[model samples]
Every structure is written in C-alpha cells, then in structure tokens.
Target: MQQYNSLRADYKFTEEEAKILKDLQPRMEELADQFIDEFYDYIWGFGQTAQFLKNKDIIAHHRKKIKEWFINLFCGKYDMPYFMYLYKIGEIHVKIGLPTHYVNSAFTFVRTFVLNSIEVHFHNKEQHLKEINAVEKIIDMNLDVLTSSYREEELSKFLSLSSFEKTILSGLKKFNSYVNLFLAGALALVAFFAIGLFVYDIYLLFFSDIGIEKGILTVLGSLLVLWAAIELIHEEINHLQGKGFAIGAFIMLAMAALIRKVLIYSLSSEKVDDLLIIGFVIVSLAIAYWLVGVKKKANSV
Candidate 1:
C-alpha cells in the first residue's frame, strides 16, 4: 500500500487524473476487443509466442484476462488491490521465465494503442490532452509495479543466499570482470600482431621472390585475418558493455585464420590434404557461427 502510494505520488497521479481515467472507461471498454486482437497480432510476430500461448484454452483464458486488465486500466480504482493485481501478473511472468524485454515491448504496444484510440475518440483538445496525460501516467505506474516483481524476485534470491555463498558470488563476479578485462587486453594484442602480420606480408610481397599472384593473395589473406581480429575486439567491447559474449566472433576468427592457411596452401599442390582439412574446418566453423547467430536471435525474441 505504501509502495503503491509512493508510485502514484511519483507519477503525480492525482484524484482528478483518476476521475479523468474513469470518465474514459466506457470508451476503453468499447475498444477492448480491438486492442486484444491487435495485441495478439503483435505478440505473435515475436516468433516465440506459441511457446507461451501453447493451447487454445490457455490462449482464450489469457485473452479474457488481458481484456479485463485493459478495461480496468481506466477503472479509476488505483489502490492497494489494483497495484497488488499488477504485481501478481508480474510474478506470473517471472515464474514462466518471461523476459523483461517482452513485458516492456508489450507495454509499448499498449501505450501506443490507447493513445491512438484516445486521439480518434476525443475531439476536445484540452480534454484529450488531460486524458492522455492520465493514461500515460497510469500505464507507466502499472509497468513500474509489474517490473518491481522481477526486482523483488532477484532481491529475494540474493537475500536467501548464505553469507558465504553471497561472498563467493561477489568474488566470482569480480573475477569474471577481471577475466573480461584480460580478454580485452589479449584481443588488443592479437590485433597488434595481426597488423604486424599484415605489414610483414606486404614486405614479403614487395621484397621477396614470391610471385605477384601468390604475394597478393597472401596479403589479402593477411588482411582478412586482420579484419577478423578487429571484429572480435569490437565484439569484446560490446560484451564488456553488457551485450552477449560473441561466440560467433571467435568462430569467425578461426575461420579467417584457416582460410588464410587455405590461400597459402592452395599455392602448393603437395599440400592438397592440408588444404582439404583446413577447408573442412572452415565449413564446420561457419555452421557453428550460423547456429550461434540463430540462437542469439531466438533468445532476443
């Protein structure tokens, strides 16, 4: 109750705003079905929606609940029970392992849908503006309460851990941070060496007895490897900034290095077996990299 009051206060959701929302309830009820239909269409585009709304019965129940929730948004009954209702929905979301990303995205759709509906139905500019403000505040407040469940879930898990376990977790996080730093440094060195390798290839091309064709191929191969190294470094930086670790980048580096070997070995007929082995490895790495990308996309959805 206190937390709900705090949220309402923070959003400046006054009694007048509540009355404004209540006044809009009839219109919202009329549009509820349209909102749910469009909502399903939007979530279905996520690709993983089937995993959640697996059966017709489940989908029907979910649709009903969503409609009720939508209508209740303008119920003008912002109280402990209302906030608790939202929190319970959030808890269910957490229990089902639903990503916070989906919650946020869904809320985005809801906000846009309601605002657009308001624009179409309300003609008085001043009243429309007031209703929009009230609606936005209430929706934001709802999202806040909903996401708080996730936060509380994480906090509870941490609180439940033994002191020693907590200490170990903290130490592991610190160690992981250090390891990422070390990896960044190592990638820097790899990029440096790659540059040197490219330079050396250029030197060999111009100064050595290598044929122009072979020399140019070697320099191009070196450049490819150098590009792969730089890409890996970029990926590592993104990981440090809280993105996923780019396993695909490492695979790319391996493929690039093997491809460089292939270019060099292709110059020697006697190295046919070596070339075949490298080619096979490169193909395998390509498939692995593709699979990593597919998995990442799925997880994001």
Candidate 2:
C-alpha cells in the first residue's frame, strides 16, 4: 500500500497532464455512466450468476449498488484519501473471491471508453496529442497497479492442491469466478438504482409536493441498499472466515436502520422504536456467527 502511494506521489500529474484531465473529465463521466449501465447485462449473461438471479429482489438490490459506485468515482475527489479508500475496495473485492480476469475486463472496458472519448474530444487538435497519450498512460498505469494489488492478495492464499486436486480446484474456481462476477455486477446495479431514487426524492422535496410518498419510497430504497450491503458483507465473510468482520457489518446495518427510522419519525412527531430493529439485527447476527462461524471452525478439525 505504501509502495502504491509512493508511485502516485512521484508520478503526480504535470501541468500538461492536468490539461488532459480537464479535457477528459466530462467524457469520463459519460463513459462511466454507460459502463455502469451495461455492467449487469454482461454479468447476468453468464449462467453461473443466473443461479443467484433466481431471487428477483436480490437482483434488483444489486443493480442499485452498482449505480452508486459509478457516481462516486466521478465526484471529483481523487486525492490520497480517495486512493486509500480504493485500496480497501480492492482488498474487499479480493476477499470476496472476485477473479482478476473480471477486474481486468471491467477496467479494460472503462479504458477503451475513455480513450475513444478522448479521440472524439480532441478530434483535430494535433497540438495536445502528446498530452492525451501521457494522460491515458497515467490512467492505465494507475489501474494496472490497482489490479496488480488485488491479484497479488488473491493469489497469495494457499490452495493446497495436488496435480489431480488442481484439476478439480480449477473447475471449481471457474464456476465460483462466474458466480462472484455476476454478484458483483448485480450489486452495482442495485446501488445505482438506489442512488437515483435517492436523488429524485430529494429533488421532489423542493420542487414538488410529493414529500410523503417520496419519503416513504426513499426509506424503502435505503433499507434495500442496506440489506444488499449486508448480503455482500456476508458473502465476503463466508469467503474469508472472518466472523468478527461479519459482526461489525451487522452492527453497521443495525445502526443505519436505527438512524433512518429516527429521521423518518422526526417529521411525524412520533417516537421511533429503534430498539426492536437494533435488537433484532444484533441477535440475528450473533446467532449467524455462532452457527456459521464458530461451528464451521470447530468442524474443520
């Protein structure tokens, strides 16, 4: 991680590079939006993911999250803190059994989009051609480092397979990769939809008289987003065998539910019964830890 920062620190964008960035921001945003839009279509196209897509509600939840992910990247805050945040994202994706190939493919699609957009943006401007190439190289290099970090962590784990076992493991890995890829894509879609609803609800608040209906819809969307997040966290925990992380995830979900309820009831002049949601989330998560985490560890012996 420190090495990654050092690479970025020494390779900061120059003035000419900054010009390329300025020229590309809008086009980048547009491409990012389309990349997110088509993510699900690609993911669901695979049969492995279709297994999880059996649950319509879960599928919808996943689509919403994907949208939020794309929007966040385009928010114009690519500082050190943002980079560190991305590092954790890479770590989490690896922990969840995401394949390096899919990550590579996803980024390749993004890079192609941006490069083509740049070609169109600077159609006849031969003067800044060198700067465009430099900027594209920087972006590609940065993404390469990110992908490398994720792959390194993923491949670092010992699978403990013999030649015969390797064949079985490879087949299993192929299936699992498809499953996680689809799951990741579906999750992105759900997050995106939720974000769209959230923004639209906010807009209606000031411009229209749909507060009550919009508030209800917003609360529902928020719950769906939180639920989808917990499901993703659970999947990651299952992969990593980290009950503690799963516990923390449930706690965060409980807190989110409580906070949302509090805000919802605030406008109604009614008392919010947060205790039930908190207690339920805690008890359920604790039971899950005992059943899945502790039991699995004990049985492994």
Cα RMSD to the true fold for all candidates: 1.4, 22.1
**How do the predictions measure up, each by TM-score?**
0.95, 0.41
Clashing pairs in 1: none
lDDT of 1 by residue, 93-188 (tens): 999988888899999999999999888887898998999999999999999999999999999999999999999999999999999999999999
Best by lDDT: 1
| lDDT agreement with native, every candidate | 0.93, 0.59
Cα lDDT of model 2 overall? 0.59
lDDT of 2 by residue, 194-292 (tens): 567567666766677768664765556476555756575566546445233344444444455555554555554344455456456656766665676
